[model samples]
Structures are given as structure tokens and as C-alpha cells.
Target: MKKRGWLYFLIFAFILGYTYTALVYNGIWFKFTDGLKTIHFLLYFVWFFVAFFLSLTLHELGHFFAFLFQGIKLRALYITVFVFHKTNKGWRFTIKPKLWVLLGGLVVPDLGEIKSDEDLEKVHKKFANSLVVAPIVTCVFLFIVILTFILSLIYSRSDNWIGFISIFTIYTILLSSLYIYSFTLSNPMFYGDFVAYKKMKEDPVFQLAQISQYTMFSLEDSDETNTYLWEKTRDTLKTIPLKNSIFHIMLLTNYLDGIIRSDQEIDLQIDKKIQHLSISHYMRNEQGLMLAYDLCYYHYKQKNVAKAYQLFDEIQRRVSKKLDPKLTTYYKKKSMHIMHIEYQDEFLEQIDNYYVGNSWIFESLMDPYETLKEYHEKLPFIEYSLPVKFEEETWCFQKSMLYHTKR
Candidate 1:
């Protein structure tokens, strides 16, 4: 009932719907006459799942053994995550172990039918002591694989049983080791970002839980990445943020990342982050900075010298004393350097036009002349947005002309 991360709850709900739809479409359930066929598919699915899950079992076992040696109490072991999103099942766990040696469930089998959040809390509390055994198990497997590979080479000359075992174990051990690493590796996007698991791993508090959590509490661990479409959107947002939020805020690292990058990379990452602006209002500054720049450039590129200069001036005024004061100066000089040639008097006058009001964009677009106005219009997370949005909207004269003509 706690209201924390209601967004995550929504996401979980959406995933639930998506998963059910996929299963139904794929004949996971059945009418009475088709029930036998359904059972056959279910059985094979269960068998393969059981075999794969056994690997996670061993992973958790490694952690549980470490806990036992360290004299920690084990409350329960179960495959915790069930019917999550698109997947029929997932893993979570409950264990009472010491503080520093957490990560136990990662080496043992996960739980089944997690009874309550209380079960999770009990496990969460024990994280500090659990042993993160996945890495240990993985490294051992790696060493075994390497040893087998070397031995295989050595015994390839002899045709002995040891050589055969070494070759066979190489493949098994390599796959196991890869699975273990996938669980604990630090990825930089989505759930893989520095925020959740990686942050937990870095922090002593949650790092302790990595063991038990990975074994039964987490499933489908991959190095999360920005798909091309998402990355493109994020890059667009990085260059411009005032217009809209395109993605869920929770999944917006790539967009934010693009904003923080340079002009060279900005064009690439904006489209992704645009999808997720609603994630946080506090992030307005991060998102807005790039948008401010993009707006200025948009106007600049479109030959809308008036609008362009207005946007530029807005950026100049909002420049933080903590930031590079020289940045505003640099861009100003660059502006004069580029525009001074064509629209000599017009561009020069617009450069100094510090009319601090909402009408900056309107005046820029409509060519309205105004005296110094009051300053009640500084929107948070940005110095100006109307200027940028106006500029982006008007950047393509061809598009503008076509639309206006069609009108």
C-alpha cells in the first residue's frame, strides 16, 4: 500500500498484460478439448525450465553453504518472482544470514510462491551477512574450464578419459560462468544502469543482498542497452528537452546521457531520453540544458536570426556562476562571427535583445519590437523553452512553408 515507486507498479501491471496476451496468443492455456495438448507443451516447458533452474539452484546453494559456515540462520529458500510481466515465473528469496557475506541465494536454488512482502523484508534485512556466491562459483567454473581446455590440449595426444572430460566440461563450465557473470555485471542502461543493481552492488547495504537476490529473487539478467530507436530518441532529447516527454521516466537513462554529451554526440542520443521525461522534475535542468542549446542552434540554422538571438540570450542569462561563464561568451562570439555578415544591423541588434518575457519567442517569430520587460517568466529546468520549441518548430523553412501553404 506504500506509495513509493507507483510507477514501477504500473510498469509491472503493463508487463503483466503483455505477458498474458503473449501466452494466450501462443496457446499457453486451452479449451477443454485442447487441454491435453496444452499439458504436453507445459510439460516440456517445465522440464527445460527445471534443468536451467537447477543451475540457479547450484548458484544459490553456494551462497547458502557460505551462510551456514558463517553461522547464519536460514528462514526459507524459494523461487520468489512469479508471473512477472511476460514471463510465467521469476525468482526472489528469503534468508537470514550475516551482513558482509550476503549474496547467498545466488549460489543456491531459488524459492517458490513467495508468500508475502514480509518474507522479502526478512530477506532484505539479512542481506548484510549473505555470501555473494555467484562470482565464486563462476570463477571456480572458469578456472575449471580453463584447466580442462589446457588439459584437453595436453591429453589430445593421449586419447585418455581425462581429456574427454576436460573437453566436455569446458563447454558446460564456460556457459555456467557466463550465466553467473551476467547476473552481477554492471550495465549502464535501464535496470542495468548505475542506479539500481549496480548501485546496490557498489553500496555496502544492497551489495550484501546480491547473493540471495540473484539466485532466486532475480531472473533474466542481461547487460541492458539502448536499442537503436531508443538511443535515437534519447539523443534527440539530449539536444532538446522543452517540447515533450516521449518515454517513461524510469527507462530514460539514455536520453539523459545524451543531454550530458557534446554536440558531436547529442544528435544521436536525444530521441531516446525524450520518451521518459516524466521520471523526475528535478531532472529538468539536465534535460533542459541541451534543449536550450538545440533551440538556439535550430533558430540559428533556420535563418531565424531574431528567434535564434532571443534563445541565445535566454541561455546567456541563465548561465550558472558555478558553470563555465566563458561558455555563454563563447557562443555569443560564435553567433556574432556567423550572423554578423548577412544581417549586419538586424543580427547585431537581436544579439543584445534581452527582453526577458514570455513574448521572447513571439517577438522573435513575429519580429515585434519591445522595451525591457519584467522578469516573471523564468521556467524551472530552463532559461527559456518557447524560444527553443519555437525555433525547432520553425527550423525547417521548407516544412513551415509547406504547412503554411497547405493551410
Candidate 2:
């Protein structure tokens, strides 16, 4: 069984065992017949859900309002439970959102257009301040609810009003505690807002983030052709130690770009680094897809055509069916490229339009063709680009021969 499947099975078994003990051993099922007890339970259940949702909404609004107060323009606002808004793109619906972004209630701000160092510094400060506002707002509202509950008790209020206050107070406190835990705790499952806020204040982290943004812009920046700035930025990224998955992925992207440019053979050093990333880390969907594509390219270079095809097929199948149109179109183009299928000029034009419209540099960075090679490698690295074309021709010929023999 898959690890995830086994985990689900274990959870199911534990729940079943607990239910059996409660109902059969303890005879707790009889409690359902007690009308007053049942009513109280239902009321608490309803109140809990209502309070929890309200608290989460307020927490997110706190961040949103903070950004507005600081005069920062937000690119997007996402809430895991059916809320998504992007500046130009408007709203989108999807089953799952990025885990870290959803958990942290990340508000992506439009800082890429700010060229001046003074503007960048001001934006970063506001962004950092906004991160803390969610937790603070949650705590403040929780305190107000607790005070109201105390006032109701002091006045010896009617039973219904007392019950209402009591339930709201308990639920607000519980929900607020959960929010606090999510902010303060460091878990491998997802990053917390407090940790990100702290990192944003550090010079190295700030610079790295800025470099990543610029690298993204370079991919879709129409008027800019000189890659000298990109080369320098990449070198700067390399100077930082690969301490986390994000850094490792960024460095791997640099190496992958080198591979596509060189095309002669799989670089052993790059291949080793690709293999070093853990399976769990690769499960981070977007980055995982990029890593999968890199591995597929390596296999194709090694003349392992069947393995390359299989890897591409698996990743294409696993991609979210409800992805944004730009992403869906990009992945389709990628799958075709991996399979060595030629595309019409119109299709390529549409892809270019999508890239420019979406400002999608990360997707562009993963392209295994002349476009990415041109953007990533210059003059001295130009010679490396020849071998990739040769490999693609070789793989296509091999595939044709195999089909003919089978026929």
C-alpha cells in the first residue's frame, strides 16, 4: 500500500475503535435519548463551527486591512475554504490550494514592479507587519468574547443568554488557540506565518526573495533581452547555502537550465543533486512537477526513452484537473515537448501570450527548449544548447523505429 493509503487506513481503524469503545463498552449511546443533553450538544456543535469560521475570516481580514492601511497593493488573497481573488485574474475555484499559503493565509503583494531600493524596503516592512496582524486581531477578538462571557455571569443573566455567551466564549477561545498554534509552531507539514514573518526581516532572506522575484520577471519581461543581470542574480543565489527545499529547488533549477543548454549529456553532478531531494519534499505540487520534468529530461538524455515517457505520463496525469488555464496550457505544451511532438506556430504563439500575460517565469524556467535556453544561458554557454536538439532528434527516431518494428 502507498504510505498515504496506509495512513488513512490507520486513522480509520483508530476512529472505529474509539467509537466501539464509547458505544458498546461504555454504553454511551444511551446519551442520545436524553433530550436536554442532546440539545446542548447540538447547540455547542453549531456554535463552534460558526465561531471558528468567523474567527478565521476576521483573521484574514485583519491582514487584508493592514495591507490596505500601509498602501500596499495585493496581487492575490486566498482562503483555503472556497475563497480566492487575484488582482487581474479575479476569482478561481479549486479543490486544494498550496498548503503553506493556505495555512499561513498568505497575501501575495505586488512588489515586483518596485525598482527603487527605498520603495522595496518600505514594501517589505509593510508586508512583515501585515503578517503579525492576523494573530493579534484573533487574540483581541477572543478577549472581547471572554469579557462578554464574564459580564453575563456577573449579571446572573437568563439561562438562554448565559448559554449563548458561554458557548460563544468557549468556541472563540478554542478557535483562537488553534490560530495561535498555527502561527507559532514549526511543523514539516506546512510553514507558519510567524516563521515567514521572521525570515522576511532578515537581510539574506529578503535579498533571496527579491532575486527570485526578479528571476521570475526576467522570464516574461518582453523588452529586456540582456541576461547579464540574471546571471549575476543566479550567482548571488548560489552563494547562499541550500538550507531548505525552496533554496534547493532554486539551485536545482539553475542546474536544470544548464542541462537544457548543454544538451550533450546528463550532467552527473546535477543528476545527483536532483536525486538528493526527498520524495516528501517533491510532493510539494508545483515544485514537484518541475523536478519531475527535470528527471524526465535526464532520462531522455541518457536514451532511457521509455522511462522518460512514463515519468511524463505520470506527472501529466497527476496534475490538478482544475488548474488555471495558463497552467493547464503550459503543462500541455510541456508534455508535448517531453514526448518530442512538434507543435504548430499558433500553439506556440498562444503559449507566449500566456507567459507574458501571466508573468509566469517559473513555468518558463522549466521549459526544455530554445526559449528557456536563450533566457538562461548566454554567449559562453551557447555551445551547450546544440546537444539538446540532437538528443530530441535521436529520441524521436528511436520512437519511430520501435513503432515500426511493433507493427
Candidate 3:
């Protein structure tokens, strides 16, 4: 569409980079992560999410401009950017003139238009244009805004108006530019919007999908469960897409199948692509969807006791309230169920005690398959802990977590 392959290039590069590094590190998770001095790199990972949010804001702002250009109205423009903190209840990034803070992943882009299905059809096409052009324009404008603001600050005038204006413009542009850069990588994961542009123009199924993609809580209508786009409804533009249109649900379903069913034959690129994609609000929710279940299951199967416990805690907050009913039963009724860390901690404590006393525990933990198998054999089989040793320090993790295994 935009020949904007460069925008996504970095996503691919990072995916390959992260996957390679993870494989190398998996071979030596304890050694690499716990190595001499990686404070800088680890910090970079944490801060990288900030850049991600900024890019998202810029992308959506582009959509806002696109809608305006086509004479469609915007009811709301939510910029879901937030700094990571334990207690903040509002938008994390704020304008000095009027700032706001939020917990992570709260920036929701909501666009509203006139009350007519016909209007929605017209606006839908405009949205496709905005999806492609707006982000590009937003990036160019932001870069200039940030650059001008940088130059503006050099020539300070006590004419308070000049200084204030310069600072205001600088913050907005800098924030936006940082965001645009994040999306403007060489290998993008969410090239579907670009793909959708060509495909949706002809396929009304894709066009109707745009609506359902964002609105998941509500149904298509009171009568039909798997409803396609409803023609008579006044606010039909915002109607939720079918389950088939739910990107996160589909991708996650596939990912879970990979680790649970032991489909190692499936390439990591196919499984983890969701993490790299930069796209619609619906898709972002799919990011990191399979972290907990995969790791816990794998470690238990391998009989590693310690690593599984920590992984459970790390990913517990993302607990899904619902799942495919069969999977819910399969995961829950499994021989080694560590789904609820809170319920099984006392038992895991006893297992941790056994490892601490056993010096050859290192050798025991090294046997990944044996590690999982033994843990599964244990009563009430909790998350098997794999206490990995790197030099002097001891770190715990599960076998299924998948890191680079360096020789």
C-alpha cells in the first residue's frame, strides 16, 4: 500500500533478534541473564515499551487526521500510553498544559461517526485510507515538530510566550516522533492493515471485521450469536466483530496449541508474530497471551520444580477469566496443574526445600525432560521448579520458557 515495508522492517528484525537471542540465552538463561553487566540492556527492554506506546499514539493520530480529511467525525481519540507503575490510575503521559496518567495498555482509540449504516460504509473506506496514510503523515509531522522544537529551545526569549510555545510543541512532537520511529522499522509483524487495505476493498467480510475487531464485550445483536455486520442498526459501525474476527483469540488459540500439544515443529515466527505486530486496538490485546500456560506446562512435563513457580507468579496477573471450555478443562484437570500459584504455594515450598539440601540438584535440574516428568509424577503436581545456576548466583525458571541454549 504505502510501500511502507520499512515501517515494519524493525519488527521483523527485532523478532528475529529477540528469538535468536532468546534461543542462545535459553541454552544459558542463568548465565546470560545473570551475567556480569546487563543492567543497561534489561533497562532498555523495560523502557522499550514506552517507545511502543508513543508509536501507537502517532499511528492513531494519523487515523484521526484521515477521518477528518474525509469529512467523517471523531467522537473520541484515546491515546493508550502509560508509564509502568504499581499505583497510577490514569493516563501516564500528560501534556504540561493538561497532563494525564494511566496504568499500562489503557490507550484506546475510539472513533465515532454519524448514525447510519450507509455513513459507516463510507467512513469505513476512509478509515482504511487513514490506517495507511495517517500514520505516515503523523510520523513525518512529528519528526519535524520534534526537530523544530529542538532548534526552538536554543533561542530562548523571556517573552514567556515564545519559551512556553517552544516547550509545548517540543514535548508533543518528541513524544510523537519517538512513537513513529518505533513503528517505522524494517520488519513489521502487523502488516495486516497494509494487507487489509488491498483485501478489504474487495472483501466486505474484512470491512465488517474492522467493527467487530474493537468491540468484543458486546455481541453483534441480541438475536444472532455469530452475527455478521448488521445493516439496520443505527450504531452498527461500533458493533463487535465475530469470534472469527477476534485476532487475539485466534492467534492465542494457535500459540497455546503449539506448546500444549508439543508442536515444536511449528516455527517460532508463526507462533510469536503477535508480539511484533503494531496494529489495531484488538490485536494488541493478543500480545504475550500464551506466556503463563506454556511455560508452566512445559516445566511440569520436564520435571523442573523451581523455574515454574517464579514464571507462574510473573504471569499470574494476566490470568484469563475465560478460554475455550475444553482447554480450560484440559489445563485445569491436567496431572500437574500449577494454574493457581496461590493455591499450591505451600506444596511448592516443600519441593524448594528438597532442592536446597541436594547439591547435585544442578545435575538433576539439567535433565529438562526428566525434570518435568518427575514433577508431574508428584502428588498434586505443582509447577516443577528448575533452579538454574549461573556462576555464583542461583536463578529459577521453567523448561518451557524457551531461552537460547549456548554451548
Better of 1 and 2 by TM-score: 2
Please tell me which predicted candidate would have the highest TM-score against the true structure: 2
lDDT of 3 by residue, 60-84 (tens): 6666667667765443344542222
Off by over 4 Å in 1: 1-55, 75-131, 152-163, 184-198, 201-407
For candidate 2, write residues 243-360 as lDDT tens digits: 3455456555555554554443344444554445433335334555565666666666566667666666766666655545565566556545444643434555444533332223
As a TM-score, model 2 comes out at 0.53
Off by over 4 Å in 2: 1-41, 84-106, 187-189, 210-232, 242-244, 251-407
User: What is residue 265's positional error in candidate 3, in angstroms?
Assistant: 35
**lDDT (CA) for every model shown?**
0.40, 0.56, 0.42
Ranking by TM-score: 2, 3, 1
Separately for all candidates shown, the number of backbone clashes (residues 3 or more apart, or on different chains) is 60, 4, 50
Alpha-carbon RMSD, candidate 1? 25.4
